[model samples]
Target: MQGFWDCMSLWKLLLKGKKGCHVSSCRVRRLMKKKLPQAWRKSAVDLEDCLKQERSLYKQAKHTYAAQWRKDFLTVQTKDAKKHQWKSRKARDRFFRLQQMKQREEARHRCCAQSKGSTGDLQAIQIEEHLSDGTTSLRTITDRRLVEDGCMQETRHAMIKHERRHSPVHLQVSKDDHVYFWPRNPENKGSKPHGLHNGHFKAAIQSPSIAYCDALFRNIPLTTGFVPLQWQNLMNFAIKKKPGDFRLSKMRTIQLMNSEAQANNKKAGRAAMQFAEAHSLIPDGQCGSCKRHQAIDLALSKQLVWDLLILQRRAAGWISNDAKSCFDWVAIVTMLLFGLTWHVLSSMFNMLSFATRRICTGFGDSKRSFCPPSAVPFQGCGQGNGAAPHLDLGDTVHHSGEDICASVQAAATLWLGGIRATGGAINPEKSFWWLIDFEWDARNGQWRFCRKCSAAPEFDLKIPGLYSDIEPLRRLEPDDSERTLGVMLSPLENHNAQEAQLVSKGLGVPHLFGKQVYKHLEMILRHMLGGTKPGAYMDANLQAHQLETGTSFGLLQQDYQNTSILASDTWLKRVWKELESLDMYVAFDSPALSLRWHHDALLIDLFIDLEVDQDDLLWLNWCRMFLQVATVSDITTADGRYIRQCIWNGFRDDTYRTPYNWPRTVRPGRPYWELWQRTLSRALLPSHGQHHPLLQPLGHWHDNFESWNWLWSPTVGLFHREGAAWTHLALAGSSTISRRYAPSGSHSGTDSLQ
Candidate 1:
């Protein structure tokens, strides 16, 4: 009975599978393996394959069901286009027509009033009479399309020149013909344009106003090197680097130069330290006691060593990266901290409402009639003990009363903090002034303008968030009548940055005096040449070199009729002829140039001009001949009469204006000519050095030995002084302007000249 049951079970299991064999359990496999190993193994493998196939079929059916559900339920609903269609074309046309009419009216109003409306609107209104884009009429559409296509097709339009000061169209039209703008079309042969003038037509000849020099005019190069290696040169070198090399050569060169600079700085630092020690600025073993000692230590510190190198290089006009090294990084960090400190100080000054002012009597009368009780002009601010506190950038002195002394002191402290934060206080020379009146209302902790004040309602000077009741703040006025201290900041006329920088680094001695001297000489020369008035010549002599080589010879315009040049008549004439022939120089006419004796500081009021050409031989001959002729006696004429050479006693540096006029006026004196004589003479005494006297505070020279020598030197030569040395003038003459005296014989001082 047991055998039959087992056989039946086996048969049942084998028959359970459809399309494949089935093994119900691993236990059955184990039993079969013990009884019939091979058969059991095969059946087990078949069962596993059947299971995998079933799983894949079930998965495929499930995905199909999900896809069908999504297709039916997740579809987006859209409205029909037919339902949203407009009911009628008439309504749409009406709406567009109304918009067009509104735009047209707005454009017309704008055109009449000259409002800053859109250009499209203006163009639309102008073209509306011929064609309207809003109109549904075929003619209107066709016209619009034709106009656009015509504009597109036209390759070029004839250019019509117009007067810069005149408008193309006039609003006050007298007729329909005048209502339109000047038509650009060539076919229109109507009345001439309203603003059209005969400017292009030839006019009657007229004489020029300003007289120019007859000598060759060479425009000087305005840029020059401040040092042996200028920053611009370095930049040029950097720009020439090969594109593919990643600028390695330029960078390497810079690095090498930087290293050399570092070494030099170290040497300088050592020398400076030794000098300080020798001067007793640094005590033995006490390194950080004195400011000098501290400075030395700071300079020598590894962090600052590179910074000093970079600073020195920059000052000498070398391009250098400030933050390219460790020193720069340290400096950046320090400056950042300093800047933060300033920001905090500025915030405090603004928050605390710190300010200073004056309150007292007037100049003309003790009674304050000139100034109202509520306010006063800047001139009538005060002249008493209660005047505004003396607050300046450097070590400040508070002039406030005891009651507000503490507040003023606090404010001063903040100001000092700001100065340190900004690296230093502003240069007194660079400070500007403006007229302003500050009001304070402690009650509201704010400032407001007084309605009765002379300033307009819009011209209030009150700064927001500041309050002070001690006194009203009166600032320096910009008005000519009220301005007391500084000139207003304005854009420089004909500004050239490169030229300005070059001029700044030029001539240690002041050049303005020389310019004045030149002007005097020119006037004298003109009077001697011809006693003619201005406007005697209308045109200038154009040189051949100028026409062909594009190099200008002589000024663009000159008045040669009034003055004449003789090739070999007088000494000046001969000198001028030779100089002009050699393309050297001849200047008795340049208003801003003056030749002077380098020795004894003797001024050569009139003589041959300098040859600034870069020729060693030419310069040598020039200086030799100039000096030879300058220091000699009068030349003997053909008729046995001595013709005194045109030479005058050199003017002093202080002599900006001359009292010696030619009895008769050739031209009206320069602005403030007479006034400058009286004012400048008293102000610029020898004892006063470069400083002006009590009357005027502005000084011509700084309080230094170099400045003193530059201003007061009586024996310095013109070529020897200032940047003339850079022109290779020092190669020829005794660096001094003076030469050894020659015995009486010929005009030239040298005996060698036969």
Candidate 2:
């Protein structure tokens, strides 16, 4: 037994020593005294000293091993990086080669198809010649050759004249000190380089060599006002407008330009844009290319006008015109004339006008055989030019009352003349006009479309250049909605009903009982747990807690114990049973008469006392309306809760205040919150039971203005102690707020009234 104890002590010391621990002689001696007899005490001290020596030797070996490991790791990393770089370069080369091969195949296919058709015609001619006399056949061939020679001579003469017209001297480029090379940040300009040499832009900023080369190439065209003939080469192709649409009219033509040409165009376009903006050449109605103006802005403006016209019971006309090939038909000569008239820089116009396009059908087509004349009298801005959109000319007109037809005719005539002057035309087939008028229908108890008062039955409006009569547009009845510029305009009465229907479908609840229960659950989750945390996080936590306890985090059990109403209700039991089968975590609060589902974070609080009957169906419609408003507001669950909190606080204390600790409280201003409160109060309070505090209208709260003495103001400094500063504050603040909320006012309406 004594020997066994001694061996265990030795084994423990050996293990500790191997782990690089210093085994003290005194500590070993004390352990040995308890584990071994008095006879082994002296030997234990010697054993501890030996173990200490081994540990030091082991640590030295470890340090040497670690150093070697790090050295090898760095060497491997370098080799890997070199290998990756080589692979990337090889892949890029392969990609370019494949692209070239594909282009060659497409060109060959087109050539073969043309050749086959021509061969059939030639064979027929040869057969006819064989049947006819030899002399006549020879004479016919000779005549064809002579005509071809004359055509070639004419083409050569035309080329010479074109080259002379585009020469530097003709364009007036004599300045030697002109600095046309302005370096621009590619990132800021959103310039994405694509072509055979696109890789040059990848390291353009990092590598001085590439940047210098790009600058050198870009300067030549800007300085001389003559693009290099080779750079003018373009490949034209057609892409389908949609996946399965093969109609010729539905195809879009695309022109591909090299990276160098693209870069030059971008610089010239930016210059032109700046010039237009500085001169205010672009009209207010032209929102297509204007900064800070969007399609939605135009749509909202039109909608507002329509609404006003409808409200005033006035007849109005709307004309929608589309230009046929707006970018492609505008002549280069017209562009130059406009530029000169606008007093644009002579060099800029020279560069833009003189740059001719020679396009081929395929990228692999030979420049001499497939490409056309350098100066083909190009019309419109080439589709791919950056400055094309900025130069585009169009107009929108609005007129009301009896002179609507005359107004339309005059506007159309004026617009067409301007378009023709710019070498552009409108497509009458694609253009449409709408006659809008509303009248109160006593039979239907709502305002309805009055076609009789809107336009004459035999009215025929026409513009000379269009060569077709303008058609009256009608509202689509299939969907009960009319869409213009992607905004859906539905009848006022049906809009709310449609929203309610959509909400009912989304919840997947056909019965009033299920809907009522779900609504209560959604309310509690949105107002309580949803505000403090994200839906995903709360769902996961609740799910985990439910799984662990098998009782929905004690909520169900607590509800079962607290009240007999929920426990005894058969409908509530059925809902619970159905919920358990679903892939969701559900909890019920008997006191609040609320239920919550974990997955979607759906909480519905009936907002009724436990004694009140939960079977009422009258309030269900109002609940749906409130939910629809919240959804239409496009607010997240957390934001909805925060907005509700703001409203509740405002109603209770007559002061709207949100929790300072709330993460997103500072995002929405007082007006935004009040707007939401007003909207929600209108939606819920009108039909909802008066028992809940939220069912009462939230009147205007007292404006609790706090004086910020320490905060710095951009215009008035730390504190506005002077009268001049206060006056400036009043004017500037009002202007800023009005500007900020102008767009918001356009968006706020009865669109989500349901």
Candidate 3:
């Protein structure tokens, strides 16, 4: 029947005297209007050619026919012309679109079919095989056909309700329904996100007493949609038993199997880790010390916005923060939440800027691998098809030492591309944390530091006077097909674009080029022998891969797709700038750029600098690779392409923006610094003396400019004891020299002479 219709159409075309019907073979005639194409390349070319032919025909018809002839032509050939025009589209596209739609409909039908069995289905997916004292172990039947999104909203509500009911405690949440924080584990391999509360956070501090805990439990007010009673009892009993001092001293004992203790204790852990692979645990979370509390307080100083009006409104350009102390928890939470709240409200109003979807994965207290968005079924966060916005919680206040383990573990969710941030990033279960964004006023040189923070710098290993004249370096955008050892500029353009949209609380001059905002960052690659690049750098895909997945390009392809899954790609830019500003490669043989101290937030505010031990520097390259993958991130689009260039600058000469001046509380014993040092030591140190080459001089002998020792004590004082550790350092106090020689042995200056 369709062939007959096709023949009829062809007859109509022939009677109307179609011009392009010259091919005579039956097969050719049959396929003349078929317009079938195979590959993407062919389809693209065919589409272009078809458009051109159509244009030529239109032009020819306009001039070739008289007005009366044109009327007759239109009347005689209307249907044929329409059919031919439709045929101009490649058949492959029509087929592909039909296939895509079929796939979508099939997927939807499959979901509906599966959902039929999930709601009150009582399906025995995971059967509880072992019930240890504090743990419940289960083995689940693999049913790939189960659609996560269609698993019934009531099922989730039931889980939450059952868990809360068992506990018999809940805080009435404001109808605002806070957005949960969903940070990722390095790979999608660790524990998933879970809810956190008082005992949950305090476990890391001191074990709760039966009386205090019991009283606290009794007193915990119940609220709607909170943890159910069953899980509450499970948690209460598990934590009620005292676990001895697992403070900073417990860092070494990662796994727990106490043969000396009760069987109940063992069972509790089994239950927690075995509930589902998605379960993440929140160990005791408390500020272990006064200093830690202060640190946490400082990090979490930003204030939360009270209402949706100020909390949710995105602009087109120029989102700035100028208060000196405004970059606190409230600010970060505000930044994420305000953006997200606006997003949610926008969704409510049907006003999303683009076709972004809702994240719907439920992260539980288990391995971080299950930390996926609860909204989208397959892919989680980023605008692209892979992961989502890796919004990491960086506020000092949020870094409670005793609670970090708990917080990182319990509150860890997969916040794909900052999408699941309706209630702001902070778990609204408590009031101590907030994730907001602030700004830095470049023109006036002011920073919006967090308002509620009162903590002072915990450690300040001052190494004053540095490259004061290192001019401000604007991040240049990577040209097509070329990547280099400098700050990429597209980040800046994207940053500007995002600031306008309230997608980010950016620094620099945040401006939107179009609807998309570029990311602005600073970069400086080592660009030397033994470095990872040239090969790594030239592979534009590699750079993009790392920039997106926050992991190695090689690792990314093997592990996941759509790799923009890091917390903050901007941090990578900062590393690049530091290298460029220091001119790390060339030994300062000439009149050198001044050597001084730097105290950016990455240093003092976070205490990452004090942590690098002498042995860990060798793996610094690898460490950087890991950390960049873990921390920094960029924004891309749905089809796996960057919307704009991230502009990276090499140097910035702003006096107020002193990358050198540091906070005072960045000493060895400080919590974060110590933790980083320990991490570096563990990563770099070996049992045999065969340490990595970078590690050798972290303290004693290497000449790398960015070494822990060099960055900390850049210049050993001239007047100090002559034979001290500082004295043995290369060109100890010389501003222009970087050669190796023992301290001038001829010098006989005595301390008494001074």
Candidate 4:
């Protein structure tokens, strides 16, 4: 019987889920297993006998015990669930009747327009009237639910799924002026978040305007892949008004379309066409004299410049994951937890939720344009160069391959032109670009593609594919296999195993699904506490490596984003491989990128406008001298003008963004103020661990140094004042140590320093 229970235990963790019942059920079952007769275990050997003898009784016992445990585990949740529920039908009726009575009495006392201290039917009805404007207000009738406006505001934003909960779909003449909501009270003991997008993040993004809607673009990605040739042809045709008088690229003529709320909420395609026509491209200012090159046409130059900059930035580091790692974790976990998470288990129940095999974003919202509250009427600043109509994937799907290719290029060109200097943030982006790559499979029939689209570089030249196709969930990849002492391990080990079974395999969190997670986890455990092999590593080197370089400082995992990479493959590979040894990386781009090499780190940075471009090389040289990279060679050009460069670096010699960390923005300013080694080293190192160096919040440097400052707090190694000691732990400038007095030429002394 004990063996039989153990067998079930391995498979049925998610199967026997309840609000809080997991721990207790295990205890009770264990107790029963100990008490059961040894002969009874033999009855479970034969399938028929096992079922006939004790299956029902075992299930009943487990269920009863599990339920009790769950009640205890989630007592707060259990209580919260009863917020609005009545005990019986009669009680429910009585509550409503009382609400009605109160409303009637209020009507007699106050104006029908406004009622205070009211939790009556009239208030509810009035709120309903207001809701017509397309708003969904999550209300908490009890005062205890009223959280401080500032404190719980973030939580409130999370509840409003802008995609589904658009602010009151239609405008309504609302009678209730005061919109009551379930306020967040941080002081409440039971207060906790239930989903992604926590308080601070939600607070930052909340906008109480119209429904959180995305820009409706007509040429959105489609069911069937568009033909690259046809797409390009369409764009060429659109722009062929006259050769010299280049007009807006065909792709620039974007239009918006509404998206369905749910997958099955399909509307007529004709309505979509109507939407496209209604919201056609924004006008671009025309040329006053020569019609040759309108602003729209000239804007390409800007786009071209931006494209190059993006390439440069990408080389620096900004990547998106294409391993589908995010989706896989969710699928596996959902499967493992199917028995427990769902309301009730079915005979056909699988631990993982097969149907919910979707990508799970940590918290950041999807990449939709963020616009102000009002839709500003766009006038063509440059002929056909301003706000154009949005494009959607669906329209492009119906188009030919040639048109699709052309559209893609045209869009890319336009996108590249609108670049701006966002200080350090802009440099890596300007240097390199990261594009997500996906494989094609025909396992599912959801997608169709044109095989020949490859030659055009506008579409996949590899093969036709669909999005519906995916491989089955892998139970345990060898890469992720960790070994613990099978014999000595306790029955209930509360460690990453639980996280793996639930969050990783069951809930399917994406980050943990990757190969890197396993590698890092092994390093982390070995460094912290010794355990068995595979599951627990005793590799001191690996642990020390993680301690000094990697982010597994005995923590579960590291969180980072905004990875970019230069277009140079050789450079990217070299940089990544190098980082493998040093562990100085925080993805400026995706992991799959190749970067361009920059011997002159500062020289390879962003210059507002290309020509009048700042001598980044000279700047880097200056930095190296100041930061104490004085002995570090190969950081400059022979002529000393800093290596002449462009964003189009492809060759190994051409500067790229890889071998780069942080890929900092080099805004045009006091170039010689800091050392190149310090700046580059700072960029190379992730702002992780206990010691992060602060670049004295002085100068017109930047404001968003929060992530950087936090990641690389004081290195606490050394310091150099004007008179006293001097060391270069983690402060800014290897050579620019904290000096009490100005010593020489070129070094400007600030009053604050004195």
List clash counts for every candidate, in order: 16, 10, 163, 141
lDDT of 3: 0.26
**Best lDDT among the predictions, by candidate number:** 2
Per-candidate Cα lDDT values, in order, are: 0.25, 0.42, 0.26, 0.26
What tens digits encode model 3's per-residue C-alpha lDDT throughout 30-116? 544563222123343454554465556656655775576768777888756653335423344446545654565577678768786
Listed in order, each prediction's TM-score against the native is 0.13, 0.38, 0.19, 0.15
- Candidates sorted by lDDT, descending order? 2, 4, 3, 1
Tens-digit lDDT track of model 1 for 1-754:
2333343344345445433765676645653554444534346556566446555655665567657755555453333223534555534644664565456557777765785333321222112233466554223322433444343222111112212222111111122211121122122221111121222111100211110110001001001101111100110012223345654333322111111111222222333334444544443324332322333222122112222221111111111111111221121112111111222212212111111221222222122112121110111101110110111101111111222324433554464345434333222111222222223333332222222233232222221111111211222221212111111121111125333544656746567545534543453345335522211110101121111111112322211211121010222222334344435443222222111212111111111122122232222222212222222111111121222222111112231222111011011122322332332243222333332222222212212221111121134321211321111121234545655322222222112211
What candidate 4 gets wrong by more than 4 Å, as runs, is: 1-123, 127-264, 268-622, 625-754
Least accurate 10 contiguous residues by lDDT in model 2: 657-666
Q: List candidate 2 segments past 4 Å from native.
A: 1-195, 331-378, 393-403, 440-447, 452-454, 464-754
- Model 1, C-alpha of 754: deviation from truth (Å): 40
Instruction: Please rank every candidate by TM-score, starting with the best.
Output: 2, 3, 4, 1
Please provide, for model 4 over 1-754, each residue's C-alpha lDDT reduced to its tens digit, 9 standing for 90 to 100: 3454654443233233322345555654564455433422342234244444456766776767767766676897777675577765535754764565456546656753465444322122111122777877755424322322322344223323323211111111111210111123122211112221123223422433311221111112122212122111100012233336644431222111111111001111122223333443212222212223233222222223223222222211111112211111122112111111111111011111111111113443233333221111111111121111111112321233344444443543343223211100111111211121111222321111212222233332111011212111111111122222111111112246445545433564466434444544443344235332221222322222222222212111221110111111221223334444445543211122121232322222222112211344344422322222221112223222232221111112222112222211222224234333334334432442233322221122221211111111233432233323222334444555552232222221223222
